[model samples]
Target: MSNLFEGSTFCIHTFGCQMNKHDSERVAGMLEGLGALPVDTIEEADIVAFMTCCVREAADTRLYGQVASMKNISVREGSPFNKRLIAVGGCIGQRDGAKLTDELPHLDVVFGTHNLGSLPALLTAAAQEGGHRVEVLDAADDFSSSLPTDRENAWAAWLPITVGCNNFCTYCIVPYVRGREKSRTLEDIAQEAQGYVDAGVKEITLLGQNVNSYGRDLYGEPRFAEVLDAVDATGIERLRFATSHPKDLTDEVIARFGTLRSLMPALHLPVQSGSNRILKAMNRRYTREHYLDLVKKLRAVVPDIALSTDIIVGFPGETEEDFLETYRLVEEVGYNQVFTFIYSKREGTPAASMEDDTPREVIQERFDRLVDLVQRKAFEANQDEQGSVVPVLVEGTSKRDTSILAGRSPKNQTVHAPLPAGVEIDELIGTTVSVKVDEARTWYLSGTVVNEDA
Candidate 1:
């Protein structure tokens, strides 16, 4: 009970992207190394650390509010919850280390991107001497160290093949905050994938800021295909990666996907905009035709591949015609889903310094129109699956009703079906089950489980 790690339990509250989520895994791995058991609820935790993010202003505000609320929870208890050592970390800590520590003195330990390996030692120090904030943002460490993690689930897991980003996209903050692209060695990544395969991980989403740009620092060129081949060699049932740069998605990589059966029928290729002017403004190296070409390549290999994209509607000087150009591309491609947003300017990005021509109301209107187009396309796309039987890896029970079960198809469509009679949750997981599409919503699909084993 003296050291926080030696205490009863610990919980990690993570924010931001997949990279941050992977960082939380390393944080958990560190705590477990120091003899800490993961707690499901903060109420039961003797130590709680917030793996924070500061990309969105809202992420920072939400983290502070969560920590402050936890403090109130501790105070309201029969005994002071000061015994529960609270901590804050990630980009927020990297960006505002001393200021954050001075502001929230209740936090036990605060660490930045570079201090993951030193976390256990820091936690030990914080427990004895009280609250401490240890941030080393500018100092990006090179050594790749391993840590302990209490995985969130079994069948599905996020396997980080790389860390950080180098691309200084005009409107992005990741490169500055997370530092240059640092890839974990191929052997390390493959070993991690093997571990998941051994543990019965059926579906693995290989994560990174720009997945296609993986291994450029190590193998000389972007070796994402090599990484994929290595992971696939481990005999993992399913494989996927995301947030690809159109420029880095070479012919070899797209061709590899065609041959790799495990690589599913879904790809999250984020084409920020369809206008050549807007694309150049955002510092995306690929042109509008290039993105369409990449989609065509992916479609040629996997015809049923579901397409999803990220589009910022009113990026700085976006004109109405530019917005219409984006809409026209959406209509032409008919993506299964489109993530549309009115761009939020980060203070340091190149685009932020540019003159803002698009009005706020206009941005909102354009965003709404983009969303409307996506909804109509999604409905039309699902209409084709009306009577088809599809195979899905049953994830678990449905959220709406436990009487039903949930899973995902090769295209990564969320499907729910009645709980198969006499089927246990353990048996249902990690196994391919056939389901008939009974109905389709804007997002998820309703299905009925078939076969006794399914």
Candidate 2:
């Protein structure tokens, strides 16, 4: 890569999951490697890139609005970033491809999910050719972990063990956009974790669409448990993984929670709907009974595990009974957090073509009720932490009040403590400090520092 764009700066507006966030970090690292500086806002930068997500219609709508605003700014007479290059990357770019350039005439470049390594060359071409340049690979040429990353948080980093999805859920477009599953070599992952620990990374989260299915492609069997063991051996302070599929969450994997010292007592397993009828229609491959069984195994191993999940309120043909089934499951499980959504039909997904007679008002009502139950459960979970001194890995100063420093407890709950009189703010970050939980709200916990050497 040549430094032809040296002295330039960039700002990346990212949307969607942790994977997308990690991709944006790698993009920033590549730009900086090409001698570009990082900027706070799009208007202040020479190039503004969007790491987009197309999982829902809302994401698409947001992208269109943001790009339109940037396009107008580029043409504005007195704008500082009037000549800025507008680039689109990630899932939306992978899906939309040349269509994005056609839609947004101001769009300078488009690169796909698997085409991140090609970004430097794509940017160079866009700058030199002065035309809309697009490069989206049919399949992943290289794993993103192989690329450099400019991590936003110094305390932690995201290590993806697997890329793409094998289970083609009827409602998800991931398989079409991200292609088949590809597992990273175990040695490469472990080495990376060691490097992060050496760089003072207090925690690391292994990322994947279905982390439980990791290593099946390579070894002909799921080796996520082994992957966890290898990474934890690197001496990392804390470990976490996300977005597990209930169908593939093996007993061996569930057993890791209680045994692995570094593995935090938290899991985010998405069960789109609790109704077996809805799950079968969605091609989720797991029934309501199976999900509860997995939950049972998890609790049996790690009783205090903070469980979170994703629930879609209204599918195409969902009935009141189906919705009530979900309500009952939420009550039974008492999830520490619940991400509820009204299902949006994507054009290519099977669920899109399914017959739907469910009314919009009914869906909205169900969504509100679900939210009420989830909030209550969340508050109860937080209340359980009262009077407990939890080990919180300090992240930084809280957003609402800078005087209070914020960090995540072992359960991944946000814990904030007032900045102590004697300690410097910088010293608190990346260090696991013990805070006696004095107050607990539905969303966060407030406490005072009891011990700094945690």
Candidate 3:
């Protein structure tokens, strides 16, 4: 088994959320442990894997297209990359299982969300059997976050405090595919944070389906605030989390924004819809007023907090008035950014079966309106940063201009700064720098170093 595929290389193309990206890192770590090298292109690799997402319908279409392309390349009898093993894993793999193999005959292996550890062995089986293998586990005894990781970014890491979802919003497919809520022991999480710090990681975002509800299944109450405190005590420079449900964002959790020194000032609370009627229909468990109230509390505690949110523009029964309420809410609470989505019916979700008679034009119009409002607010927020000195965690050179380095401010705004004299961009990839904002755009800010020594 040790020499089965020695000296081979693998390329993993990951699609979807950060969790899937983290999973791909673990996969790479596992592959490297099996004596595999990482390759940039699938054409040059002996193994190709896809870590997929099933959150939206388009992912399925994209997956099919990619597989079809791979089939053309890898399935040829005399092709140079003919020996490559094509593996599929994550939510899409977990959802479709053997059907993926049936649909795409060239696919060699399919592993599930809970069985990322089994991938190497499954590939081995596929190679040995001269046939395909499917290893889709309902759940795993251990968390995938515990596996070795080959992090792409040296300055940051994702530490999963919990996995799976407890809040099965009718439109969501996460709980079905990712399974029920399971919180990692607090000790494990804290220890992981300390490890990241020791490894030169300056920032870590705690990962979960609903981060604010962390520890509820195990501790009988949500202890996310305490988790934040534990990680903050590790002396990590920056802390953040993602996709927090508006209902589960308790006052204690919101209060931590003001108290935790390392915690970033940005929050991504997703309020799916703005009308109470639409909210109840989606089983969101919180009303529009409740969400606005939480926003007020967050601002009250931390006046300069930068807020962002997710907005679903068109649900099954959303009315013109319902969309106006969403528009009103967006105007009422100016978000630093809003991730707008026109509702797409996922096959397994309850919403897929409901009547979606809302015209496509209406949905598109609402989506455009929301997008415009969000962009305006974001531009205004960035503009406000002008004539101010903000601390940014330098992430490396900007993709748009290599001469200009970029980093993120405490509020999670991208601040692109010119490299100071005789300083290389690589040297500041992980350091915090004080940047004086000189220019502000809708999505980012351009600044100069205000205090290099600071």
Per-residue CA lDDT of model 2 for 1-454, tens digit only, reads 4557777888999999999999999999999999888989876788888999888999999998899887556432433333778899999999999999888898899999998988888888778778888998889866998888899998799999899999999999988888899999888899999999999898999999889999999999999999999988999999999879999999988999989989999999898888999999889999999999999999999998999999998898999999999999999999999999999888898888999988899999999999999999999989999999999898889888888999999999999999889787798888988899999999999999985555
Relative to the unseen true structure, what is the C-alpha lDDT of residue 297 in candidate 2, on a scale of 0 to 100?
Answer: 94
Candidate 3 lDDT tens digits, 1-454: 6576677788899999888989999999988888788989877788899999998889889988987787556432432233678999999999999999999998899999999999988988888776989999888789998777899899999888888998888899999889998999899999999999998999999999999889988899999989999999999999999869898999888899988899999998888788999999889999999999999999999887899988898899899999999999999899998888889889989888989788899899889988998999899878789889999899889887888988899999999988999999888899998999999999999889976565
Per-candidate clashes come to 2, 0, 0
Q: Give the TM-score of candidate 2.
A: 0.97
For candidate 1, lDDT tens digit of each residue in 134-201? 75657555532365665666676788766677778898877777777788888988998889899988
C-alpha positional error of residue 35 in candidate 2 after TM-score superposition, expressed in Å: 0.8
TM-score for all predictions?
Answer: 0.93, 0.97, 0.97
Task: Please identify model 2 stretches exceeding 4 Å from their true place.
Answer: 1-3, 74-82, 452-454
Which lDDT values do the candidates have, in the order given? 0.79, 0.90, 0.89
Give per-residue lDDT, candidate 3, residue 389: 92
Candidate 1 has its poorest 10 consecutive residues by lDDT at: 73-82
Number of clashes found in candidate 1: 2
lDDT of 2: 0.90
